[model samples]
Every structure is written in structure tokens, then in C-alpha cells.
Target chain A: MPYIKVQITRENVTSEQKLQIIQGATDLMVNILNKDPEATFVVIEEVDTDNWGVAGEQVTTLRKRQAEAKKLAEANKPK
Target chain B: MPYIKVQITRENVTSEQKLQIIQGATDLMVNILNKDPEATFVVIEEVDTDNWGVAGEQVTTLRKRQAEAKKLAEANKPK
Candidate 1:
């Protein structure tokens, strides 16, 4: 069985988007690996930013820093 | 970097349990695969039964059928 787990930050992802992800992953497995669609499983996981870590820092912290940097750059831009 | 994903049906899993799973998975990768714990990522995914399927049937449907069968068997048990 070709099982695919797609993980993304917990944003407001719609049900339609989840459906598309499941369908696309299943299609990829069937087309490339010659797997049966019935046997392929695709699970979409939405993780909270607080729980997802990158470079030893939580995504929540990283995203906040990015937002601040962007705001600073916009303020420095010539009007 | 080693990334491990653990998927389970949504069944009231607690925060402590999730932490344990993350630690256990990271330990496994470090002990067996010689991977650095700092570089290991463990993500726990809780999926609704409606989204999980087996044998072309949703887990929700299968679990209902199982519960019904169990109830029937218990009722028919010899006294």
C-alpha cells in the first residue's frame, strides 16, 4: 500500500483542498508506482505552528520574526 | 534530516501521549538509524475515521459495523 502523509501548518485549509491533496497523491502513486487507487492511502495532517519546529525554533516564533522583518523593510522603502 | 510521522485515528489522544510519541520516535531514529536527535522531526497526525479508508470502505463505516457485530455476539452469548 502506498501511504502518503501530507503535513502543513494549521491554517484555514478548506475541505476541498484536502480532497484535492488526497486525489493528487493517490493519482501520483497510481501513475508512477502502478499502485491501485483502492490500496493507496493519503492522510493530511494540519499541525499547529507552536508544535512544528524548524532550526530548533517553533514555527510560530519563526513566522512572527518574518512578519516583523517584512514590516520593517516596508517602512524603510522609499515612498 | 530524518522526519517521522505517526498517524492514528482520532480517539481522544492526550497531550502527554503526543509528547511521549515524539520522544519515542526521535529516540528510535537516533538509536537505530544513528541520526541526530536535533535533526530528527516527529509529527503526530490524528485523522478522523471518515477520512481513513480500508478495503475501499471508510473507517467510520467499518468501526460501526464492528461495534454492531460485537454487540450482537455479546447478546447471543450462552448464559
Candidate 2:
């Protein structure tokens, strides 16, 4: 069982959305590796945005990195 | 990989204690299931005690339940 835990700053997501995210992540795992979602425990934890970081940088910076990567990928596409 | 996440209220524990807890839990898994710690990702999240619960009951009550169970078992022992 591959356990994936997500620490999210956004607390406003409904329980259904939370379950969907868990299932969606589990689905990705299952689709990629043929693992059973029932065998995988995916936990999504809601935490204060200020409490998490990555590579000694704030999470907002990480989000920005994703957005920048998407922009760069879009720019490089053949028109 | 079974990822076990622990959300604790006590925040002032030494980093050593934190690591020890992670290793201890991982050791239990390893001893029980012969799982590799490297492959079995166990993440322990430090959360406010007020934010966590079990079976619609607070974590403190859960601790009490464990203590009570131990006491009952002790009382029933042949020794």
C-alpha cells in the first residue's frame, strides 16, 4: 500500500472535495501502477498555509514555480 | 509502502525525539511485515491536539481508552 499524505493550506474545501482529491490521487496511483485504491491509504490534511515549506522556500513559491513551468511549456509549444 | 502519519499536539519535543518516534514506528512495521523503511514512507505530522479526533472522540479520550484497556488487561492477568 502506497500511502500519500497531502498537507493543504486551503481549509475551505468541502468533505466531498477532500474525498474526491483522495480518490483522484489514488486513481493516479492505480492507473500508473495498477494498485488498488482500497489497498492504498491517501490522507489529505488541512494545515495553515504558513506552516508548510519546500526546499527552505514558502509553499507560495512552489505554486509559482508550477505556474511558471506551465507558462514556459505553453510558450514552447508549436503554434 | 505504508505511509503512517502521526498528528501530535505536543510541539516542544526534541528533534531527536521526533526522529526516534519515526524510526520506532518504522521499526515496528519492519519487524512485523519485513517492510523496508526506505520504501515504506512514514510521515508524522505535528498537529494541534485540538484539531484531531478518533471515532468522534478527542485524542485525549483515545489515550484514556488505551490506558483503561491496559489496566483491564493487567487486572485479568494470571500473575
**lDDT per residue as tens, model 2, B9-76:** 55477889888988898998899999987887767676443333332233444577889999999999
Q: What is the lDDT of residue B6 in candidate 2?
A: 73
Give the per-residue lDDT digits (tens) of candidate 1, residues A38-57: 88877767899999999999
Question: Per-residue lDDT of A1-79 in model 2, one digit per residue for the tens?
Answer: 7766666786476655655666577787789988765566555567655677768987777778889999999999999
Supply candidate 2's per-residue lDDT for B42.
66
* Candidate 2: true contacts recovered, fraction: 0.00
When only chain A is evaluated, what TM-score does every model earn? 0.88, 0.59
Query: Where's the lowest-lDDT run of ten residues in candidate 1 chain B?
Result: B50-59
Candidate 1 CA-lDDT value:
0.82
Candidate 2: Cα lDDT at A79: 94
